[model samples]
Target chain A: MTHKIDIKNLNLYYDEFHALKSVNMVVGEKNIIALIGPSGCGKSTLLRTINRMNDLIEGVRITGEVFLDGNNIYDPGMDLYELRKRVGMVFQRPNPFAKSVSENVAFGLRVAQFKNKKKIAEIVERSLRAAGLWDELKDKLNRPALDLPLYQQQRLCIARLLAVEPEVILMDEPCSALDPIATMKIEEMMVELKRNYNIIIVTHNMQQAARVSDLCGYMLLGEMIEFNKTSEIFTNPRDKRTQDYITGRFG
Target chain B: MMKLFSEKSIKKALTVIAFSAIAALLLIVVFIILEGLPFIFKVGISDFLFSSEWEPQMGRFGIFPMIIGSLVVTLGSMIVGIPLALSGAIFLSEFVPRWAMRIIKPTIELLAGIPSVVYGFIGVMVLAPLIRDYLGGPGLSILAASIILGIMILPTILSISIDSLKAVPQSYREGAFALGATHWQTIHMAVLPAAKSGIIAGIILGLGRAIGETMAVIMVTGNAVILPKSPLYSVRTLTANIALEMGYATGMHRQSLFATGVILLIIIMVLNYTATIAIRRRVGKK
Candidate 1:
């Protein structure tokens, strides 16, 4: 399997407190990988480190490297903006810009300085279709994205990232605020999306991980306890901590 | 039962206190209208508003010059102040470290604590001379007043704008940056648009301050009651006209000054309403 992202012996610190300790994992291309753990287990922190999203926080320090494709993203000469473009993130809550649906999708293209109006419109439609939002949102393209229902808004956010044509999509609890139906819809979209792009999701729902992820990693206290095929991780966890977590004993 | 009675009495007292503030404002509005409107009718509305002549002793009380002066000076101050205040707000909110911003913001706010006379004093002693030596015409001109007023309104605009910018959710910035937007691009495209209504409200409030200011304007504007030909020409604002004349005027002349006060009140009310409408529209859209 071709490794799309290689996280090598990564350690992260927020001031004096170590947030992620000696974590390492390789994510395969065009597949869904889920990271499951309780809050403060550093699953989100690990995910953020992949795109240097943690760099925005003050007093954050990192050692070791995250390699995207073949390039070390932590190199001194790496362009932060370019790295983020190639690895986009969807936040926990749906955070659509206070703009029209079409404009939200077109934002990334505009940031890349794509100025042709016709080309932007084409890309916006394609991105929305890819995120499975075109049929419901086609006539409402000019309406404000914030005015949409929460599920549609979340889909709009996904379309926004798709517009930039990223290689990897990181979701940080993308459905925590959503109802079960909405969560299921996003999970369905994720399974479809992994056919084209690598998806790494941090989810609290163990069933969600089982349902959508091809591979799964269980984390405990900034440590990746076990990583294997989703069925093996769920049905026959290797580590005691992973077994305890999957069985609802403790996290 | 005794505790309940006291609680009811306390609520009544607080309600009376709040309504007293409203009652005071209503009294002032009533007084200004009563004293000003009769004089405006006596002089004839067209002559009072449009005629340029203003020899109050000779019973020619046209206030066209001061009206124009107030409008021009207020507009000029906005032009000078908006860009500086906006950039300062962005820098403080986005780029500055927390430690540095805490110190710098309070220091800038100290500019507001300084008295208006002191601001006028600096304009007279420093700015006016620079303008006179470099640009020609008298040191006290409309340009000088505009610059001074712009500086005076800076703290108001800066304080409000920084708050507006800071109020934008951090999620928007994260979303923009995750899309490969540079810091400037993120601020300009995402953060700024969300804060537009608030920034505009700050600007209009600053404009209200510029127009209603009396003492500092009187000290720097040369108090000339003429139709100014240019920014460099000496002029008198409505606030300046009222303050400069109210000390020693009889009957109709005093009423004319009150009429000028009425006009100033109207301009300020229009500005406040515009701010209300702007904020209301933003809420309605959401």
Candidate 2:
């Protein structure tokens, strides 16, 4: 299968600290790929490279290539904002804008230049439905998004990403801020969402990577130690480190 | 040393400090009201508040002109000051590099440390002349005072606004960028809305600063007693009015100056109440 995103020898530095060290990875089409690593292992850093979100950080110097749909996103004079539009991201913490429910969902569309009010309203409703938040929020469409409970807020964030029609979604430990039940719901939503868009998730929870992902890449320090099918990585033979990590030996 | 003389003693000491601060504030307010209210009652509230005539020797004290002057000048200063302060705040909080911010923020705040008399001296030497030269009417007009006060209040508004903007989480910016928003769009749509109440507080605080200013205002605003028709016209504000007459006046004139204090106190109380509500709403949201 043609990969949705391909990264080759990706190296990133934040000032003097070497963040991601010559990372190489591939995410298959419409599939869920999880990056499992310890805290500060550069998994989230690798994920941010896909959408050039790292550019927002000061003193970040990146080398190597991240390709989205066979197009090198790190090419010189690239439209960074346009690249971001096609590859959406959800943060570890749910960060809905301090706006009404409908307004939060409609924010991406508005940024993308959708000015017709009726059209925006319809798309807002549809995206919320896809993220499984429509029915819960339909009645309180005008209530501030911050008023929602934590899980609902994350779901609303997902709905916001979906509104821009992104071909791929990057989630950085999306459920880390959520409870176990909320985590389960987000995992289920991810499984369902994979039918429409490619997903790359960086997670600290190995069990979550096992339970929700189709494939897994075990990362250590700043390197990807193993990349394979979830079952093979979790149940069978693999890199000694991946096996050790999954078996609860050491991160 | 026995747990710092026990937590109970510390608590009692703290309570005493807090109560003393409250007691001091109460004393000042009661003193002013007691000194001023008898004059207001003797003159009648309507004549005191609504009439514009003022001759302490003639027993005619209508400060309607000064009240209007204070409002007009304060509003003008905010109009001149807020947009610059707000834009500068946004640049500081969202765009400036860390190294630059370290230098720039302290420099902006230092503007507040300049003595009001120094600002007044500059207004006399530089600003008033420019206004008189260009805008007419002796240069020390409401326009001059507004510009001076506008500059005076910039640090207050800019610093407070920057604080509010900084309080907004980085996650909001990341979320906006992930949706492909340009920096300006993200700041306008996401960051600004989140910092709204704090910005309002900053503006209100700037307004309070402008309204209460005396020395700088007295120097720049020609201190005319007539009702001001335009920004170019010379006008005397409530604070300037009291400062101008309190030295020579006797009896009722002295108390009337205290009455002016009563009016200034009321205006400040209203502004302080509004600012507290805004600050509370901002904190409550988090």
TM-score of the second chain in each model? 0.97, 0.96
- Candidate 2 lDDT by residue in tens digits, B1-286: 8887788899999999999999999999999999998999999999999998988889988999999999999988988899889999999998888789889999999999999998888988999889888878888888888888999999999999999898899999999999999999999999999999999999998999999999999998889998987888999999999999988978999999999899999999999999999999998888
List candidate 1 segments past 4 Å from native: B281-286
Q: What is the lDDT of residue B120 in candidate 2?
A: 89
Candidate 2 lDDT by residue in tens digits, A113-224: 8999999999999999999988889999999999899999999999999999899999999999999999999999999999999999999998899898898888888888
lDDT of each: 0.92, 0.92
- Candidate 1 chain B: worst-modelled 10 consecutive residues by lDDT: B277-286
What's the TM-score of each model vs. the native? 0.97, 0.96
What does DockQ come to for candidate 2?
0.88
Candidates 1 onward: DockQ, in order:
0.76, 0.88
Q: Which ranges in model 2 have alpha carbons more than 4 Å from their true place?
A: B1-10
Q: Give the DockQ (C-alpha) for candidate 1.
A: 0.76
lDDT by residue (A84-141, candidate 1, tens digit) is 9999999998888878899999999989999999999999999999999999999999
